[model samples]
Target: MRCLWLLGGSYLAAVDSARLDLSQVAKDPTPLCHEDIVDETCELLSAGRNVFQRGPSGKARVLSFGELQGALHTTLDSLASYMDFIDLDPHRAGPFMVNCMELCSLTVASLPLTHRPPAPDVACYTSDAGVVCDIDVSDASFSNISFDTANADGTNKFEHSTAVKVTVEMGNDTVWSPDVAPVDPEDRDDMPENVGLDQLRISVANLFRIFPPFELEVTESKNLDDVSDPQIVEENGTDAREVEVAIEVSPTHSPTDIVGSGDELELDLSDHEQDDAAVGAGTGEVASKRKRRASTDGEDSPTKRSSGSVTEAAVTAAELRSLLGEHLREIKMAWGDIQDRVTAVEKVTQGHKKELKVVHGKTKVLDQQMTAVKAKGDATARKAEDLETKLEGLTSKIEELGIKNQATGDGSDPWGEYLARRKEGQPGRSEGGEERKSLSEEDQRSLILGGWLADTKRSIIESEAQQILDMPALANFVDTNRVVVFGPRKSFGILRFKIRDGETAAGVKARMWEVVNHVRQNKQTLSSTTGLGDEGRPMWASFLKTPEARKKSAMCSMTRRVAMRLAAGVKTKEGAYYNEDATTVAGYDVDWSTGTVWSGTHKLASASHRKDISRNDDYQALKLGWVDIRAVVAVTGCDWSEAHEAFQHEQ
Candidate 1:
């Protein structure tokens, strides 16, 4: 009665033939990804901005679907060179049909500052077959295996951010339950080592996140109890069960080979996860595209039909080809929609600008009017205050006279009579007999300050927002490191850094992969998926997978898709090689040269000294990967001002 463990997607079900339970697993969606065509909204904003920037002479470039297609081509071409694989599209269709995967090669190459994570962090295998990646791991995206750089005595391993939720069930020898933790195995001790023997059978279902860019949502959890349930059988098979073991994914990290408790490990077949036998041969004359079918004509082709008997209405190869084309066409339509939205956004932006001007003018007028009104109010308040004081004094005097009158007669003498009597009697009376004014009860205390009034203890307002960026901690790391920017694929920004001596340039390149791997795109977080109508309501951002829910694909290491580069030098010692940095910090010039990689919003977070690289105690390289860096670390001990001045004018 030994226990086994499983993670990510449906590996356990595919590999295990054992009867087991899977009751508590769940998938939660987070808005990690989305895709839209370059529409009017995107067009107007992206296109109009360039025109606005140029002011007069520059042509206002409208982004076409073709142009976008071209951009994708450009990006993919650059991306493929690093992966060293060819794109697979027999018909040379659109990228949508190709299922463009997140570029994890770049992320892996530059992260952890030394060792890179394997590719295939997140993926969607469809009805059609293919690997998410179409390239080879380059020096830009890969690192030489370091035997002694890691701190661990055992083998060093890293998992991509892709994950799945699992419940640790009770076994004769195990504790299996559900817990969601963002920490990667490389970042922490992943599964408890002493928990179980391989004899225990584990089971769970794979939940898909309906969103993209690596989000996951749990769909259903199956247990031994569900075999009798209709939904379980309807979902394909209730015959198999979950078995804990390893599953293999392809180069770009989509699940491929699955292993089990016994020898039953095999991958779950999706619409696209193909059988090895059906795959078109990897490298041959068959992959080449013919120019005859390639047409510059914009018209779409109609689907052809096949001839069979009862199912004679069944689809033919020609029809399948056409259907594929239509699918590609649908992808194109999505792209067009994106473009249209772009244009619409542009118009909205222009309208907003005009409205903004009008609003500004109104604001100015209001300010002036308010100033005058405030002055008038102050004058009125002062006048009223004076009047109030006068009234108070008069009231006090009147009260004194009333008191004297009351004392003078039982019926209370008239005011005129009291004064007459006062004059007669008081004229003879000394100063001691003269009446002094007393405050009226009405004026004893301000009504606003009474117990019945509202109570609001107002604190003095502070003048500014406190800085949340940890300045002291940032100073600590920057003082020792330099920065570089490189990628297995290109979109990395101008990286800013200060590097220490002895670190290799490749080491920096590998380390850069670590940072971009975890970039949280705003598309999901920008809006609440489960919309709230008004205030005081539950709010959630759109995502394919939530923090608790996971989308596991064995070793789904999309972390490699993000690329990074660090600044360092290459030096040769004897017959071996050495990578080193020129100085303690590489600043402005480093940023200038790589402005496209790190110059903008990206930050080098989660920096880890590759303890695995120091396994045998070699310190030349760090484990290059991303580990949840809580803050942005800068290159310290450099003349930043001077560096900026020198590179400010550079393009």
Candidate 2:
């Protein structure tokens, strides 16, 4: 009888020899016995656990040997429900199922087990096979199996629990005893009796009876009597008498030996022969027999033969030597021709080497020319930078004179004059006293929107002020006091400064333009001073725009405020923010809605009232400078439409 051991759905051992006597196995603690097998299996399981524990975060929860054995028992019991028993007889199902459970229980009992941690009571239900106990191992219930050190600690130790539902069924009925208590390893007196060796032998016997070991035999055979008949042919035609022969000459043998004496030359017919005379004499007899047979069969009778034969012809030693000499002469002539071809190839190779040297010399000259051109290019760049510096100095001087003349002549700021003319409904004039062309309302609005505000809070504005102060050409002429920084908030702020002493606002603005050009040219200096590295946003300094431009910007800010407020309301009601097209207030589009009072208050509720604005449509629109003023007026009301009231009163 053979023995097959299966564990965890895989074959553990397959012994083809005679089965061991259980009586002897029990008397002696052999590795083949059931008790030793269980111990070996436990050792393997412990090794597997150790492997599973290793990870980047360190070892997982370490399970004691007893706890691991208990988990194995529980896992096997659960797997029994899914086992296919179609190959077994249903009539013997009671004994077969009992043997399976007994075999599993006996193996687990043999282990030096310990009590597992108290597991939550599992709820089971009856299925077609039996009752199934289920413990939810979902991520929500059990922490996800993680190797991340941050998530792998004592708090997540429960994630390694081996609790599983066990299903035990009898013939056509579910058999589970609620009263049956689990084995207590700590209390030896309370523990169930250890299975005796005789009981273990009986369980093994029943297991083999129910599930016999598999065997396969293969054989091969052949028949020797199936032979094919040979065919006989009559030779009526005459055989060809011509014979072709070849002679091989050893390189060590002398040509004089070939011509000196015929007796010295020997003919070799068989390649395997050590002696040339023996091979020649044997081959000559065979040739004589074939010739005699052919001559006797000619015209007198048709000879019948089952197979063909080989015939050899013997040549005189003198003739063989002559043939060998002719072959040697041809070989010498061919060798001479090969030497001539090789010499011609060497000559062509020498000519190619000479050409390569000439090309290499020309390459060196081109490299030298490139080095000289690069040097000239560097000198030209230095001269261009010097000319730029001189031009900037001349421009600064010219602006200083213009500001002095303007201040003395008018005693009025150019920007203030321009605003005054607009207020009086008169045409404005430029700093040069030239009348400016009339602009359309759209063109005027475009200018207002495109220009920067005097008190705008933008990082670029602050960065520009830093760049201007850091410049070597302007640093001495314009002090920190002259570079007045202004804004509603800290950090990102505005800049306002006159370029020269006694400079009118127009002259200061003109000089600022010239300084901006210098700043652009020295970008590395500007970036370092502003703390705006190469990867940061672009920066430049300029004179402040008209008040109208500031008002337009404020209006745009108000529009964004209204839109943001509407988005907040939508988010609060629907639990999600929406874009401008989807936002609605009081059953109307948010962009066209009038202000609505809060439910508990009579005062109007607007976006400005809320401090936290989510990154919704309005927030993104503000970043891109796309807020609409009409939407602001519709939602905020005309009372707050004026730039001064909206910008000043609201934060």
Candidate 3:
């Protein structure tokens, strides 16, 4: 049987007979010579002198078709068993794909036939149609062939019908069974003789359960004897009747020039065994034991040999046994030495393991120490942060004291000056030493406000005041020095000053107009607003245009807008509205009748306006009432002191 393995895909079925290119075989006629085929097959099949003779020395011999079939079947079974050891069930693994193409190639290449083309010589993939396998061995033919189809000793019909059929055609004559359906060969005529047999065919069905069973009958017989082996039909375990299927010659042999058997080959072992027996004369028992060992292993002993070749093989087997025993002794001695070394190594390893345990203990102790240090470092870091915060606070206090000390002279005081004037019976003094009469608090406030007009550049007392009063005369009030001032209204008393050198009612009216204009302009732009009730005027229009307030030039409306901005906060129980900075009172009131804008009622200033100014260093100073002109004068007095020193040096 010449089995063509179907791997990867159904290539054997996919490729048609027309697509096969057998031209190379036709052109060459003999791809491998008879001698080359014999040499190649020697490694796999049993070899005999007749099977491997040189050219023209003797008749050429070939392996019978039954032997080839048995070799291929046995090889396949061995490979399947090997795959099982590796847990690869070939049946379940599906068709041999490209992944196993290498394994398939090796298996095919290892077959004992030179005329057989290796798998790599043919294309395995679909992209290329490769050379077809055409094994022809009609030239190296064996004359002596036997057919065995005896049914097994069973009454089972399946076993009775399961048989292997072999046929040979010799020059236009079928020497085996003719074209016929299923029949017992026992009932047929004897196999034909006196025919020059050249081509031999063997087919097996149901040899194994995996392959589908099939059979073939004798078809046409031709005079030409150059038929190559056909692809093996798959075995599909069934009892179907046989038919006339195509057949071919094997690749391992040539035409019918000889007849031989490859079973009687044996190795000669007598010389080595005799030498061992002479060397160990007293070891007759050992020799007998070896002979018994060979027998137990299913090998024929010297006494059991039936032929000269078998006797020679038995002697060679005895020599091998003696050599193997010597090797075993040496191996035992080497293994004992290895065990001693292993024991010493184990002792060293145990000592190392104990030292490692000690080192691990030390490592754990170091880790604990590191953790302790880390905890201490964390506590120290927290302490350092606390110290940093305290230091920052102290630094801020020092800086505040420095700025205050730099601004205010040590001995110069505005309150002290007022006290000195009162003690001297001089309520107000002129530069010419005239004893001025004491003025009302309202008049004093007007004087202070008037002084602020000249000092507006040096102070921010009215910085939040909006330019609401747009009267031209009010714009010139600063130049005229005709404003009044009132502020720093403590719970016990109020402060007032006057700078009465211009028309007080006109300055007041101009300021009122400015306030009304600011409210009218910024009714929507300001953050919030209140106290300006509906005076029958549009929100965008000047409140002074209302019929009732027009008489006062909208002075009442302007006053209300000012009061609303100043008192923009939640009112306290004392009727005071505190600003967002809870310590700062919202605002104070203005007594326009006396031209006095008083603010001391809530310790605040009744500035004409107070916009929602952003908190910045300069504006914050003004908001905190730290921009008093007295403080400005005291800080700036050192400039005059330096000038006096310069003048003295000039003198």
Best by lDDT: 2
lDDT of predicted model 3: 0.30
Q: What TM-score goes with each of the models? A: 0.18, 0.20, 0.17
lDDT of 3 by residue, 1-651 (tens): 122212100101111221225575456553222344333332222222222322354432232222232333223434344344344445332232111222222333333343234211232211113322432212111111111111132123224233344344433433332222334545443222111111111111001101111111213222112222122112322111111223221222111111111111111122223222111111111111111112222333223333443112112312322333333333233333444465579779999999999999999999999999999998997676566546655664464445334556576555677788888887643335543334422332222211122223211332212232234533543323221122221111111122334546556545444534544555422111223453222223221122222223233223333334333434557865443322222333444322222344321221233423452222112211221222111222223333233223322
lDDT by candidate, in order shown: 0.26, 0.32, 0.30
Q: Model 2: which ten-residue window has the lowest total lDDT?
A: 281-290
TM-score for model 2? 0.20
What residue runs in model 1 are displaced by over 4 Å at the alpha carbon?
1-108, 111-248, 251-334, 346-433, 436-651
Tens-digit per-residue lDDT, 431-481, candidate 1: 465343432222221011001111211110000000111234334322222
Query: What C-alpha lDDT, on a 0 to 100 scale, does residue 40 get in candidate 3?
Result: 34
Q: Once superposed on the true structure, which residue ranges of model 2 sit more than 4 Å away at CA?
A: 1-329, 332-339, 357-372, 375-379, 382-390, 402-651
Q: Which residue pairs does candidate 2 place in steric collision?
A: 66-114
The all-Cα superposition gives candidate 2 an RMSD in Å to the true structure of: 37.1
